[model samples]
Each structure stands twice: as C-alpha cells, then as structure tokens.
Target: MTHTTRTNRGLLRGALTLAGLGLTLTGCTGTGDPAHPITLVVRDAALREIGADCAGATPYNYVHAGTELRFLTAEGTLADSHTLSPGVAVAADDRDYGEATRVPSLCRFTVDGSALTAGTTYTLSFGDRKSQDFTYQPGETAEADPVIALPPLGDPTTEDTD
Candidate 1:
C-alpha cells in the first residue's frame, strides 16, 4: 500500500478503537434503577372538570401511601385503548386535553384495583426502580368561560304566522 494510504488506515483504526472503548465504559457506569412505577389517583372534584384548562390543573394526583409496589416493565394499554411504550411518559399531550401542552399531569397509568382505598394516600412504582408519592384530595371546580356564551334566539311564541 502507498505510505499515505497506510497512515490513513492506521488513524482510522485507532479512532474506531477509542470509540468502542468509550461506549464500553459508559455502559458499565450505572445510572441507578431504570424503572420505577408510580400511581396517581384522580380526585372526584378534579374529575368533574377534567376538560377545563386552569393553572395547576392536574388530570390526576399522585397518591403518597408510603408503600412500594412492583414495577411492570411491559408496555400497557392507555385510555385511548391503545398500547404504549414500556417506559414512555404518558403526558397530557398524549390525550384529548383540548390544548397543546407538555404537562405530565396526564400519564398512562394502570389502576391497581387491589390497592385502591377511600381517603388514603398512594404511590406509583415505575419499572421496579423509581417511585413518587403524592397526596390526593378533591380539586376545586373550574368556572365556565363567559366569552363562549351562546347567542340568544327569538322566543318561540313570537314565531311568524305563514
């Protein structure tokens, strides 16, 4: 091979070797538990106005029950009745929230039928690692928008005679 071609080949091999080594080192470094399942409950008041847009509006509240649950790694079904990615974050944008937003107030969650209790806190365990607890209480009702009121029509008794 020509001298220039041989030198270029050597440099390429060295660069590839360094890249492989870097990837291997990064793989060995742990980033803590990769999966933690969390659970959130929708309060009755919040349920009434779930379609309303308001500040601090959360479709559901994460309940903090001081208990851990097993995180399921498999993808599950969503409210739209469709399957989702295993670790996908189900946010408001994924559902029909009336507006475009990145708020995580809405997420794809499985309701644990066995863990539900009235007037109690709960927590969600995600993928067997990360978990968060939240207190759930009835949310306030959102007022209707006055600007969107319907136009007044003429009284039925005033209809014109043919």
Candidate 2:
C-alpha cells in the first residue's frame, strides 16, 4: 500500500473515534430540560392592609401553620398536595406600624418541582383563600418568587372566596 493511502486511513479512523466520543457524551448528558422548583412566599398582609385593628400581632404568629398547598393541573386534576404544617420553618418579616402597635409575621413555602410538568398551568390554593393560577415554564430563564398573601385566617368572612 502507498504511504498516502495509509495516512488517509489513519485520518478517517481518528475522525470516527472523535465522532463516537461526541455521541457518547451527548447520551450521558440526556435531555437539556431542567427541573424548576417553585418558591412561594406567604405574607400576612391583614395587619399591613387593614391596620392593626383586625386581631393584633399574635394572629400573624405561625401564619402558615396547617396550611394546604394544592397544585392543580390544567385539566383540574390534583398533581400533588403539600401541607405546610411540619414543612419548612415559618419566616417573619415585621413592618413597624407604630410604637403602640404590634408587628405582624410572614411565611414562605417551597414547592417541589419534580411532579410539575413543563408548560402546564396550576392553581396554588392556600387555606380557604382564593387561589393564584400560574403556568410552569422551565427553561434557561429564571422567574421571580411568587407571593401568596395569607390573610388572618381567624375570620372566614375576611377570607377571599373570589
């Protein structure tokens, strides 16, 4: 065989090896889709909105305790449900109303995105309040944290049934 023929064969073999390596790496990486975890911030806005005359600061204490977070699919099916009772510890953000008034606390809950389907709509209902509907879009971009207002659950009349 000629030297040129041998050289050509070696070059072809190296090309094939590199191509195979690339395909193997691509398979290992799997799909580009990424899991998106939704973080919900529940704020007790009753004191802040309707003044401190509602119930006082103690009403805001453990605001998210025993709250139900339901993730409803677009077809109105229950995808998953999580109770915030023994979940993540409640966090408080107090705003000073006045020296004579007591401060209120806020809460936050994190939703697992494992069961969340991409490009699907979900209504996240908390307690007896009106639910907030949102679409799950998983991609390279990140979205701001969603805030769900946790009004004083003391009074059912105060709840937003709408």
Provide the overall lDDT of each model, using Cα atoms, as 2-decimal numbers: 0.26, 0.42
CA deviation > 4 Å runs, candidate 1:
1-107, 110-114, 136-162
Give candidate 1's TM-score. 0.21
Candidate 1's displacement at residue 21, Å, is 50
For candidate 2, write residues 40-119 as lDDT tens digits.
43343233322111221344443354666787876777887766532221213323456634343223334556677767
Residue 125, candidate 1: how far off, in angstroms? 1.3
Q: How does each model score on TM-score?
A: 0.21, 0.42
lDDT tens digits, residue span 39-82, model 1? 22121122223222322124222221222333222242211111
